[model samples]
Target chain A: MHNASTASTTEAATVPETTSSVDSYFADHPTPPFLDNYKDRIQDLLDFHASSPRPIVLITSGGTTVPLETQTVRFIDNFSAGTRGATSAEHFIAQGYVVIFLHRRFSLLPYSRHYSHSTHCFLDFMRPSEDGKNIQVVDEYRPEMLQVLTRYREAQSKRRLLLLDFVTVSEYLHCLRASALLLAPLGPRVMYYLAAAVSDFFIPTKEMAQHKIQSGDGSLSLTMTQVPKFLSILVHSWATSSYIVSFKLETDPKMLLPKAQQALARYGHQVVVANLLHTRKERVVLISPVASTEYTSNPQYSSHTIDLAPGTEEIEEPLVEELVHRHEDWQSTSSS
Target chain B: MHNASTASTTEAATVPETTSSVDSYFADHPTPPFLDNYKDRIQDLLDFHASSPRPIVLITSGGTTVPLETQTVRFIDNFSAGTRGATSAEHFIAQGYVVIFLHRRFSLLPYSRHYSHSTHCFLDFMRPSEDGKNIQVVDEYRPEMLQVLTRYREAQSKRRLLLLDFVTVSEYLHCLRASALLLAPLGPRVMYYLAAAVSDFFIPTKEMAQHKIQSGDGSLSLTMTQVPKFLSILVHSWATSSYIVSFKLETDPKMLLPKAQQALARYGHQVVVANLLHTRKERVVLISPVASTEYTSNPQYSSHTIDLAPGTEEIEEPLVEELVHRHEDWQSTSSS
Candidate 1:
């Protein structure tokens, strides 16, 4: 499935390097305050898992926002609920992997995803005693609730899962960079599952309005420059040994495979999990680089499709399982 | 309190009529499908409360998004967690008022606001028995949780609170218009508490991209037309006899009062609750029209400040009380 022309075309689209250099982008944007606090927390987490045989997975989830003003009244936001990342994190945890969840503030998390953002309140799950002295989960939900609660408690007690949060794209980049650099020492034991829907464009702070954009001005015109492509730098420079997986979400079905292949070729990442927006939960195509042999002519890359019956199965279960297997292969090959 | 000059200046900025007329805006934008379903629900709700003495208040909460494309991948979003609207809904319920909570989808709700969207998950507040047979709220949070549970249960049992949600500005406007028209029969007994942070600008459907906007085209420039000022029409036509209250939120402290006053003058709405972004949770100014008797000129309109000693009080409590008092006065005056 390696379409060279399409891949090269998409490379230009995905990596609009004319906007700003990677180094300048980092230098120009101020590091978020939370990075300093997360440094201590992430270090503590890594230290706790230092001697454990379990692989450590960093799952970045949700959507990053681009502020339009200095004192932001409004922002440009990507559309995502973090379902893929949250669901996948739970699978990784179940498979005996230590998890570091870096998510958008108030977006879904692994254990809490089931109840938090639903139309029905969490209180709806509770049933009061006849005497009104005690409360318990309703009969219908108790089984699943108890299971989730037990696993959550186990993870918390063992400190196998660490949580971090970000609001804006700047914060997300800073945190991601800091985390990747920290996780670099872990080498083959680390996996970077980047599922966050990072913004493609952003209004530079200097170009943004100091106050709210007033409506009296005939029409409001916003000029936003393309955000620097950090995936290339992340793969080549930061945590180069870690097995990295990035998602390519496309609304147009025709563009999905090509864009995924292009992202794989351009970024030189280990895997590109490609899915169409409408059927993302039901099916996904995992595209990765395939090694070439001297005697035979083989495809430069391979694509494997994972399909789940809608409503009957969670695709993340199979997706994570496949990735874990591939990660193991990657680890063994890298070590040799 | 009502500075005429400032009010006029704000009127020009607030209602940018140069973009489109109210009639044209409605004609151009397609109606949201939920409006038809909500019409029946609203009628049923009104029928249920036909004989009740409790006042009915429609509270619009949270922020609306402006989609960038027809099949939206990205959107411009306002900054709001629905704190004011959710907090005020609880107060209105406590004050013997029938509540209709119209809010942003997945934003905070009244009782759920306390636990949902917190840094800690709701599971953290629960404890499972040693044998893992039973689960209950932890000792520290039981009191408040029990109180909130009781009130929520009562509201559910009585059908005193109704919930409706919208994500985009188009959906919000369509729903708001339909609800206002349906509630007009209630006359002076009805109140409109509009606390939602709506987008001032929107890229019209005709102008929006059909698919996701590509980033390869150097810098992206967005030209957005002003959203029509519907408040004026809502007050004068849709729900003429209802006591209308709108919010004016500004990042600039100096622009806050003037904009609030201008909104009041331009819309001829009953009240304008003005607050600055940083100090909003602690203090707000309520501005309203004063009767001009032939005898004396009482400054045209009056402004009353509501301040909560931070961390000690919920501003919504006193703010709701003051609004309730003013609503009672409005009803009496209208009838007389």
Candidate 2:
């Protein structure tokens, strides 16, 4: 909506599936999209997605690394499983949608000559498990991942394992802001599953010890600042016209709805998910605050309330089935 | 559950909260429980959190720095609003649970200490408006967070902006592996929101990046190795006794269930959240995979079958709520 140019009207007519990323495949010249200056390619892709009806799914995972002074000062590394993004991507790939699985930090996904993933996983001479179970588990990798690797082995592609890591919050912010641009093309119907533990603030290096954490010293002080909310950026800028969904994982007092409401209000996402801390089981809640307050009375065994709006052609039924029938019987105003 | 001590009793009972950290938090002290060394004056707060019924909420809010080599590293970061942890903590606090809202990267939150966040109406950040009617909405923040920050500020609590940025895959992994111990005592209600963008794979230091971007080679290489699925650790280890929830963000693929199933299988979490990317609206599917193949079929809707088991006595209801209904349902259930 905030484009510098109208772009070619034909872009709406172009649904280039199996297309290239910001950088198209050159076969011989495998360059990152940023280098190829494939802005048009992405711009075209954005227009294409905007003009299309297909739902867009963007997957962002892993940590970001930055270039700093003093031998490249790095901070804030994490122990992420990469499972959130990897498995999610596989799911997206299977769900009949074009997936831009952007992985960060230590991911085990295969690379293509077209995409150079910074290798984030590594081997540690980890201390043997208290009982040795860790060794047993860590000794072997996952099967699905292994299969993906094998597929890559036979696939005719060359990949460089780009192991990009970041310690400073700024570096992660930069990478997130830039790479997040990838999601621009896919307008609306955008659902973001925010499953990452993002930092809220960064401390000053002078207060933090190079090694050793001081307990209750307050001496190790940090000047805290708010990081840019990527979800907000997407809604307010990148995909401002697009529908966005985000997450809120919490615990302690366990206030789910208030947080959900806050999320909906602060980030402009249509839905906000709030889950309790240590909720290893399936008790996560999906709050659709935008739904009419009337949902409180819309009784159905349905665990959630789905708001069906007019105009948009909804398939035979909502994607999620109603656990219980709604009390209201409506005449079908034929829009389809 | 293999144990270093063949004595499962000892291993289970005395499970060190953080013995396996590759990046030791107490490296300076070199003691297992550093709290004990300080003349026992520290009150064993960390231990209390481990045993606290309130369940420990460990939030990692900063980005990680990835290293190019052992000595040189780049600061890779993402743009994120620490809102996820900060606000979520407010919700949890209002829910009447003790929360350990750990943060990094950003520094400030707007609220008074001890404020009951749920007592106020929060602003709707997710909605869009052309006339800026929505923009006029008063921004809402939870009160508990305000209260805590106020206390911390007034107490002059010895604090540091704890931003955990990682620049290399290994560094991220190291930090991640280290912090996992924190969850040991708190056990199962652990909800790891992988909202961070970690690099999927990286270029192996060896024979990769020879033609750096500065040279305009525009070519980078990597021997991408999959990062270990740390999320699975939650499943295999404690969730064997606790619960795990994960999130999946999608783009282009509207069909979101299968990927959720894949996440369930791989991570063994009770719930796998699937959402679309780049939309202003929030849309996600909460999938709870029934571990058992035999499901009770009503033939009306796709049934969500779950194997119910209790992790701890105090968690029975919380566990059930996570297993089936929403968190609000739990409140209703508990109150009713």
Candidate 3:
């Protein structure tokens, strides 16, 4: 396996020096339209954190798009459904941490994630009351709805969860940098959970088409540059002392662990959760500098999976619990 | 603007002759995994239609993804949210037609479209009862929910709507051809609404990477060939007598009408709905062989927009009504 650091360095040397720095990247790309509102929302979260002693965790979820044109009729996209990040946020909230969920717009969200993305139509969950004048949750779904509702209401009432969203890679990166810098003062009390499927390559703004590319020219050929490695910047400068957990998703099982280990060695982050495309929901491996452990939904390892009612499985429940325990241990050791 | 027909012909000549035929393209590409299930679904829909004199309209929605690799960690996508197709399906059912909705998985659905893809959380529409034992739709949204619920229940109980979905461009095209051939016997009684934003170019299966393309290779360069044009075959062979309505969405307003008209002349389809990327929800022009007419959401043309209470607007309401009228006219004229 290639060392990620060496690979990135070699690639960077070939590209213009101006494109290597994060600052230069932002200077070249147009600022996202909602930057002001994003900053204001971050401020609101910080204010809420100031009034409480709870640790704040920022969870970035979903896939980011790299537009092929300025007008963006076509783009490159990843295959993320945002299931891992959104599910993890709810678990973090349950562990009494304040969550700032920065997700892809219209992907998924905490609490609502249970039903919104299901194949069963939302209308199927509702039934008319006996008189047909009112609509109510079906009896079978009421208990689950109530559980999610109570948690959601508790979080809302306490102002513990702040939801923010982005659509494209540029918007995501800008918001990530701004949020990290804004929360820098919190030091170890802040945690960064980067689960988003960020684009590895992008067409630079200077070379992208001004409008939609017409197919009348016969074949379409595109050359995209590697996106600057931002994880190193996030760990070393943006939120230097924060607990950072990043994800490595791969289709090839053999590449999973090696790539994840390379990410840890390269960026010096706290944790790297590795998963395969086909078996992700059923299995995952958590790799840290000190240890590597596997979690699975197999019946034999029921304890490693969520302890829901028999026949019901949710791997995220156990995954989040494990992370929370690790984060707590890290907090105590570092403070001492 | 270049004529679409001439451009397609010119492009076709440059490519190997085998690449221009639909049959050859399918032979080169792997059949989508869901082909069997897709055929079964179409059979069910055909059985449903056999018993009813009601005309059937097949609505294809959302964007089809063109995969960059056979394993597919990443893909190229278009900017369609499937709102147009979902909204039109509901309107078609209201017009007393049996509807077949072939959509991108998790994009949107007819009744569920009202809430599923919205920025507002689904939980936002629910409130705990005074007793805290049950949940009900909030009073503010009850009237709307009731209206949608009634219609949804009516469609379900009457078995008037069948929902099928696809994700990749290959699956979409395969399903489309299968559904069209199955419905060919219905002739003018069937309508084909092709609204899915299909990729114009795709990397041939033979050339696509079997594993994720490593970014360590530095800049990524790709060459994609123009997708074979299937509309002409759909018009001439697949479902020749069906009322075919295709969509032309361009970011450039200047090219909209001419491209749409060219499509009509080349494929001999009945209608081509021309829309600009930015104003598609608010305005669209219906271009037929003889004339082109615009439809807008402006209250002055309320009859052309869904007549909700004074402030609310939905362009699909009027758009579907106009199409239903046109279909009815064509039905009568052809039957005579």
Predicted candidate 3 versus true structure: per-residue lDDT over B87-173, tens digit per residue:
999889999999889998888889888887777888888878889898878899999999999899899888888888888888888
Among the numbered candidates, top lDDT falls to 1
Q: Which of the two, 1 or 3, has more lDDT? A: 1
List TM-score (chain A only) for every prediction: 0.91, 0.52, 0.87
Alpha carbon lDDT at A260, candidate 2: 62
Question: Sorted on lDDT, highest at the top, how do the candidates line up?
Answer: 1, 3, 2
Of 1 and 2, the candidate ranking higher by TM-score: 1
For every model in order, what is the iRMS?
A: 1.2, 25.8, 1.1
**TM-score, prediction 1:** 0.93
Instruction: Judge candidate 1 at residue B149 and give its lDDT.
Output: 85
Candidate 2 chain A weakest lDDT stretch, 10 residues = A323-332
| Residues B1-336 of candidate 2: C-alpha lDDT, one tens digit per residue | 111122123312222233343223223213323222322321244454444444333343333333332223122333333333444443434443443333332211212212212212121111112442221111242233333434333322322112233334454444444445545544444434443434333333452332211211323222333333545544455334333445554443534565666555444444555544443023335575442331222111123323323453222133324433343332243335
Which lDDT value does model 1 have at A196? 97
Q: How far is candidate 1 from the true structure (C-alpha RMSD, Å)?
A: 4.4
Please list all clashing residue pairs in model 3, or write none if there are none: none
lDDT value, candidate 3, whole model? 0.79
A1-336 per-residue lDDT for model 3 (tens digits): 111222234322122223356777888877778888888988887886797778889999999999999998899998888998888899899899999999998888899998877878889988888898999888899999988988888888888888888888889999999899899888778888899999999998899998889988879999999888888877766777778889888888888777877676566667887888888887877776542221111101011222334564777777788888878877776577
